[model samples]
Target chain A: MSFLAVEELVARIPDGAFVALPPDYSGCAMAAVRGLLWRPARGLRLLGVPQLGLQADLLIGAGCVAEIETAALSLGEHGLAPAFGRAWEEGAIAVRESTCPAIHAGLQAAEKGVPFMPLRGVLGSDLLGLRPDWKVIDNPFAEKDPILLVPAIRPDVALFHAPLADRAGNVWIGVRRELLTMAHAARRCLVTVEAVTEEDLLADDRTAAGTIPALYVEAVAEAPGGGWPVGLQGAYPADDAWLARYAREARTEAGFTAMLAEFVAR
Target chain B: MTREEVLLLIAEVARLLEGCRHVAVGALSPIPAAGALLARELADGAMRVSILGSRRHSPFTDGGRELFDCAAQGRIDAFFLSGVQIDGAGNVNLLGLRREGRPIRRFAGNFGAPYLAFLVPRLILFRTDHDPRSLVERVDFVTAPGSGPPGVWRRGGPVALLTPCCRFAFRDGRFLLESLHPGHDLEEIRARTGFAFALAGEPAVTPPPPEDWRARILGPVREALAEVYPAFAAGLGG
Candidate 1:
């Protein structure tokens, strides 16, 4: 296992790659997002695990994301995500809008190495009307009940921030199992952690349950405050003041550019 | 609107949530969260309230996945949802106005509304903004259908819709005007609402919350809401 710098880790991801991101409550790699912005990676397709918050907004504002497949993009209590909305209205990004659980089901199908996953609900909604790719079919097991089947979401890379990782590359995600599914489903899993622990995380039964075994991890990097602005679960609290400031400042293109200059460029 | 008026709506929501065991509040829903907390308090902690982002209120340890799992298992009794546009047919449009290929105006994508609308036993739709644009004749996009066809196996669908102007109880795949807010009348509701809804006899004025119950929500419930929605809690005084 190799430990790399945030820049180096982000540099490994090619332009136009299908990148999966962790949800808001799960650890989001803001430092890596900054690195991607600095590199100015273009045409990346973002896969939002159920939802996206500041990370997706920033990426869209930076002009990195060419397409986004997600459930929703909104800054939780801070209100609507500005960049995503602007991009969508301008037809700057291709959006494959999906429901939350359906995204989870798609990822789970990829994790289980299945071609598609059957999901309940969404059969009669306009969500089905838009996505011609999704099909409603009779449940083979049940007599005539119809269910929606979504194609598996196999991302090229899964990126996230976490609290701790052992030197062996096992990440301690701690109850955020969606990260595990992302890692298992993606071709490569890259993570940035607050600390690189000297002790093996799996040695203790308590930590073992939360630890993602090193086998699934492709690369690990030590980057404290990696999820700054967005909180790392069980590690540090979200910088609410900064987030509020971001929500205020990221409303316009000039404001967003200035924010990128202040936060990402420096 | 006055904070008292908001509180009255919340009280009505609490009344709607009387027998529900587990009520879940989604993101961007401060009033529903407040209502669920108030309901839980009134029930003497019998009702389980889970606000999506709250560390204190949410019981699930596994993030959002567990919430969906619990809803699928028929564990969640009630849930709250809203939309950019809501039609008389009870369809909600979270997606913005779709032209041919892309939407002219873009809102947030449908998160879990389609799934949870089917799974949860009682679904309450709320919108603080009650205007011709918001309450439409037909939604441009149906994020979640209010009612599904027969043999759909839905355990739940929309039960009621609450707006700042009035309350609507959904039945027979359409919303029926249940009651009007204290200051609002039938004519004003008709003028403001873009959709056609059946009036259930003569509309009665929505009852105000008990005087003592107001103290409970303004004090403890407001304090509790600070954990998940600091902005909304801070705005309560104004």
Candidate 2:
């Protein structure tokens, strides 16, 4: 397994890459996201595995993202994600509105190598009216029953940060199995971790059950505190003061840029 | 909002979700989380509460998809949703407001509403802002509809809509005013409401929140709430 430098790994992701990112609570490859920003790329597409937060907001604000598909974009208790809110209000980015289960179902279809997945509900929703690709067909198995079928979403890359990675390149994500599904559905997965273990993760059964084998992982890089500001489940807590300050200042474009300057400058 | 007001809302939510076996609350929903916890407390720990973001409160070990799968299997009985715009017909718009078919204002997009609103038997819709603007005659977009076309698959929908002014029960595709909170009158509700609703008889004032709230709310409830919502718990006062 080749463990490249973090930015070197990020350099392989071309411009306009359709990247899938985990939700805020889940691990986020913030270091790689910042690495993408430094490359001066544009028109990158983002897929929020159901939802997103500061990572998506900052990317959108930095003018790297051209389109976003997600169930919701929010900062949890911190408040509305200001940059995405501004872009949404201005119609600067094309928004593909979706629901939580629908995104999961779509990805599951891809994970299974299926073309589409049938989902419950959304028969009369106005959201369905806008999404022409989302089709409603009679349930072949049941009489007079209708269901919605969403096409599979196969992203160009799945990027995230985790607590641990082993010498064999297996990443231990513990009970957050959604990350596993994401790696299965995406073309390739790129990961950054707080540390790299010397021992084989798969050598132990306890860690093996929770590990994503290197077969699914495209590359690995060790970037300690890579998921900062956003917490890595079971590893750290969110920096509340910094997030609150972001919520307060990121309301204005000038404030967002100022914060961005202070961030990369670190 | 005052602590008493929040407790009042919690009491109302608990009343609505009295006997549900399992209730799943969305992330950042302090009031609903508290209410579900209170209901469990009232049930003598016979019930289960799943607050999405909190590991201590959640039963999901399989990650985010398990919650949806659990709801689809007819397990989750109660859930909560708040919309930027809610119509008389029980359609919720968490997405931005549309003007002339163009989105002008955006709120947080619809999270899990489209599916959960159908599967969860008791869907509680609440809005802290109860003005005519928030409560509309028709939502610009139907993120989640209370009623659907004939043969459209739907298991359940809005049981009741809670607002600062009053509580309205959903029946036959429209909200019918159920009761008003103390210090709020029917006239205020009527003036503030954007849509017409049915009234069966003289509206009754809801029972006041217990004065001994600190005993229940500030004790175990606050401890559990603090675990998920530390700042909110820290801000809670008698």
Candidate 3:
């Protein structure tokens, strides 16, 4: 398929879709998230691969996300993610807390088409009580060893920004290979990339190592400077001052509205 | 936290990681990251230090799961963790605080503390604030328990907890007084602490940043730290 516009790419995500997003340091599809604000998605169940940042906060603040399952919601060194924090505190949205490894293991289970994945630790945490889907089964192999088992988390959509994609639709994610797992586990993968290249990304062995083939990608959008505010690894750096401003202004309801108005093109 | 206190914390953390081969510092932990950097410097660059959020510092190419994988495989020797509340039993609550069973404040949730705490030996718990509210009799929520039931599989857990006021060795599933930082006393520690701890004897005074690594920390270590923690590194420059 040829490249679509970012808004067109986000249109593919159905309302109330279970979408998995990458962390801040990873390639977060900020442009597509912005497009989402314009094309409002309601009752969306958002999953942070392990954690989230400004992208999740904006969605939560805008009332686009109804449920969120994440290990962490941070602005990293920038400061507090006020919207996400307030949502958790107020119980305005359904908050499903998890540890990082559990989320990864759950998705990996889905990627492998398994029922569940066993992970070490989390045997005594309160997090177990919160997640009914997780079970503590005694290892059949070992006499008395107990391990935690997480149900597979197959997302409806996996969305992210990437540095490059070719005409054939293979996306280059570099070292953030968790995107591979996300794409594999999701029913459909939507990618908004910084640029589309003429050269084949898979033909070169060096690029082939980092490329996700066209088979997994459902659609690709050419969203220039797509990973804005938060950044793509080699594409750009995080806009710290802008993130700080977001954290500050998103503290109060009016402040959050003001931010929406500021960013959302009227 | 003053410049001196931060430097002191770095020195202490480095001391705690003397024999460690690979140490990992999570994001938002500047002191521990600096300590790991200092430890690597002291070891003549022989040790492997992975500070998350820095492309230059982190060696993980397979992605976020690699760190947990490393800990599981015994590749990581030491790691740093902090909590909103840490109790006498060393149970950490990185989960938010509550008021009358209602959530009031939330922290950046326990990122990898639950898994890493159990896998990595020599888990050094660090918190700048040494106060009663934070050092409680019991944490409201246990993100990771200090020790578990007899049948529970745990390779390692809290070995020590370093704070601005004092250092406590986590032994027998509870904190034991090791030393008091300068300008702090036994009474202050007792008053500020919410739980009971064993005062085996008179606690020794905590030492200043050692002479040998002090210069290296402020110079090359701080420079290295700037890649991930620019704002924090700038504070140590003066």
Steric clashes per prediction:
0, 0, 0
lDDT for each residue of candidate 3 in B92-112, tens digit (9 for 90 to 100): 999878777666788888888
DockQ of every model listed? 0.68, 0.80, 0.77
Best by DockQ: 2
Against the true structure, whose lDDT is highest?
3
Model 2, docking class: medium
Tens digit of lDDT per residue, candidate 1, span A126-182? 888778999888999989899889999999999999899998999998878889888
- TM for every model, in the order presented, reads 0.96, 0.97, 0.98
Candidate 2 on B42-72: residue-level lDDT in tens?
8887799999999889989887899999999
- The positional error of residue B156 in candidate 1, measured at the CA in angstroms, is 1.5
Q: Which candidate would rank higher by lDDT, 1 or 3?
A: 3
Each candidate's chain A: what TM-score? 0.97, 0.98, 0.97
Model 3 misplaced stretches (Cα beyond 4 Å): B99-102
Candidate 2 vs 3: which has more lDDT? 3
lDDT of each: 0.87, 0.88, 0.89
Ranking by lDDT: 3, 2, 1
Candidate 2 wrongly placed segments (more than 4 Å): B211-214
lDDT of 1 by residue, B73-107 (tens): 89999998899999988898887776675567877
